[model samples]
Target: MNLEELLKSIIHQENELYNLYKLGETFATYELPSMVEHFKWLAGEELRHKRTIESFLEEDTLKGTAVIDYLDSLSLEPYFKDERAEPADLEDLILEALIREKHSYELYDRLSQILSGSLSDIFKMMRQEELKHAYRLKILYEMIGE
Candidate 1:
């Protein structure tokens, strides 16, 4: 995909993640207090990431950088997964969130491998954030299991 397309896709995926976090937050309300807090934190982080990516896109566009549609092929599998667990299954909710974070990390990591310079740096940063999310979610998941 072209640079602009890729960026748009990334932003969309990030927003989808934020929405998923919101869904998790709603479910958390009836579960553990800690779960509610964690979901909110994750949702906020996702929203922040989405805004960051959008800012980067705007900057790059204004700079007349490589945000064109020149990719030989443009195909990105959807990254957002539905949270299928019921409200009572708080652990399942956490597991689903963890899975989303891991998927996002992998997606950004893959993009970074194909890109260079600023794009690469942005993807790497996003990948790192996803990793952080996954780590926190993993810890929360473990605590809930305990």
Candidate 2:
């Protein structure tokens, strides 16, 4: 509700996302050709997001009111959709990645609307990055599906 509480909640979610991506990279590295680089890159993005979120707590210039329970309405289904899934092929892997990116993108976009000023700008940037990730996954999925 207040700044501290909001930051704690956001930081927790960001850390969860970061860990998920890190786990994804770890699994990707075990593949034959190895998807280490791609997953690693995405994981790095998530790490950056985590750091960015932490900064908001300390950034006085950008400190506006944070929307408490902002993510309460957002479905966690897509983010966890393939958690127990084992990818049968590269296409499957790409589909799972796409789901993750799309969910993150949607969250950022919605949060941006609820945020104001510089914080909104940051969320918008994150949303665009996630969109790019989704596009990349789509291309990979198409290529592997053929």
Candidate 3:
């Protein structure tokens, strides 16, 4: 894909993720009250990601040949995972969110490798944020399971 296409695709994915997290937040509000705030935070983060990717469409630097080459070569298959079922319980909900976060982290990790300079650094930072999200979810899971 070209630079514009890639950015649009990423923005779409981010919006989808934001919806997923929002769903989780809604579910948690009644069934898993302890997790409501966490899900809200995750949803906000996803919205931020969507906006950031959208901003890339206006940046001339992202249209460079090297960036386009990386975009064309990037495999987005793993970035699009299967639709998650409604969680039956708190554990299920947390696991679903954790899995999505891990998937995002892996995608950013690979993007960081293929892109150059500041773009690579941006992905790296996003990857780290994903990792941190996963870690926080894991901790919450352990705490609630106790």
- lDDT of all predictions, in order shown? 0.71, 0.66, 0.77
Where is model 3 more than 4 Å wrong at Cα?
81-89
Alpha carbon lDDT at 142, candidate 3: 86
Q: Summarize candidate 1's per-residue lDDT along 1-146 as a digit string, tens digits.
A: 55666667778777877877787777667666667788888899999988887987888742344333323432345453333434346676667667777778877787677667877788799899899999988887777656
lDDT by residue for model 2 over 30-97, one digit each (tens)?
A: 64235567667777877788788778777743354555545455444454343544556555666666
**How well does candidate 3 match the true structure, expressed as C-alpha RMSD?**
2.2
- Model 3 residue 96 distance off true place after TM-score fit, in angstroms: 2.6
Question: Which of candidates 1 and 2 is the stronger one according to TM-score?
Answer: 1
Clashing pairs in 2: none
- Best of the candidates, TM-score: 3
Q: Where does model 2 exceed 4 Å of error?
A: 1-6, 32-34, 58-94
Candidate 1: TM-score?
Answer: 0.73
Q: Tens-digit lDDT track for model 3 on 81-138?
A: 5374477766777787787787788878887887888889988999999888898889
Model 3, poorest ten-residue lDDT window? 64-73
The 10-residue segment with the lowest total lDDT in model 1: 66-75
Give all TM-scores, in the order shown: 0.73, 0.66, 0.83
1 or 2: which has the higher lDDT? 1
Better of 2 and 3 by lDDT: 3
